[model samples]
Target: MLAHSEWKAAGEQLENQPVAGEQAALNQYAHLVRRVVAHMRSQVGVVADRDDLQQIGMMALLKSIRRYGRSLDEQFESYAFKSIRGAMLDEFRRLDWRSRQSRKEAHDFRDAVRELRRELGREPRDAEICVALKISERQLLNMRYLEQAEVVESFEMLLEQQTHFVDSNEDIEQLEVRQLMTQTLALLPERHRILLQLYYTHELNMKEIALTLGLTESRVCQLHKQSLQLLTEKLKG
Candidate 1:
């Protein structure tokens, strides 16, 4: 969260004398903040405060406009969507909403799943994981939900960090990072690659992606998690 003074400074900057179509662009695209908030609310579920996310989205919008030189275009919309979503996710990370015990449970659950996968030579089924962990199916699902969020957040943060250094004059290290990312992505299955692109690049939620791909939401979630895990492992290697 931004400090009170920081918010005020941002407001003052945006409210200053307009440059040509800046005001018009602001007015025209003001609804984007709301749209982003609504989409994010659905994605994050009810754990996050709608009003707080909206405020963050608005601030992100102001920053995006300034960053893009107050121009409104198709490209600007994509840029602002990513900016707003990134800001909201950053807040979530800062808040650390999950309890300490919950995080531990999630970690244990993840470990159990990985162990079962290694033993089974494939992704473990829900029943297999529940039995192995001595947990109920409901508990297993809850852990999976939490782990899904953690995985997605971790993957996004990694991408954001890597992409930050990508530029025309990027050094060899940065170029290698980019190449590694591309190669890792290419190694994923076609469906996994498509799912990652839709979720991260196109910013589609799980439900929307399920509908688009003609799969159940649960299946989509599974693929999403698997895809991210593969990317994370390969990239880290």
Candidate 2:
């Protein structure tokens, strides 16, 4: 979170020479850049280059301030946070962080689980999947985590698109979509709403959200999926 004084200083600095002000703003918000990069790295695992991600985040932050052209406040912070994260996600998409081998392993893991479920005539247990796949429970958990991360990432991409739509244009169709999304969100369960807010608005990752809500990260992931499903179904209705 940015302090009031920091925001004030950043706003004052940005009123000066453009290049120097941008640098000053970046320096003032360097801590925020680091925090966002750290959170992204945790989500992305070791495959992400921290230095590159931080550079992306810093650039996004600078762009955000210039684009906003408003007083530095809580609204600016929220806007900048989303901008920074969206830029990082764009970089990740460009990099294709998941290796071919990792994708193949994930595909195999899913196929094995599906086969076991069909053969058993029920959803296979974690222990069963581990045995059938010749993987340890921890490995199975990691696979599941990757799957969950994919779902979360997909939802975040949708959100990033929506944010762009809102920012770039406020056409009638977009307004209607925004209204419907608001209504759909309002209909969600209280816990689901909070989880969505924490993740999307507050920009906390699943692990941090798990600690805050006193639930396991896996449960948070499931609830996240469930919440998105409910929103989708409601919007369709």
For 122-190, candidate 2 gives per-residue lDDT tens digits of 877766777888987667656766665565566655654454453455244445555656777898889
| lDDT, residue 163, model 1 | 61
lDDT of 1 at 40: 48
Q: lDDT for model 2, please.
A: 0.70
CA-lDDT, candidates in order? 0.72, 0.70
Candidate 1: residue 181 Cα off by (Å): 4.7
Candidate 1, residues 136-209, lDDT tens digits: the string is: 86565456567677777788778766564435532454466556667788888898999988876677777688
Off by over 4 Å in 1: 1-27, 34-47, 104-143, 164-181
Name the best candidate (by lDDT).
1
Query: In every candidate, how many clashes are there?
Result: 0, 0
Model 2 lDDT-worst window of ten: 164-173
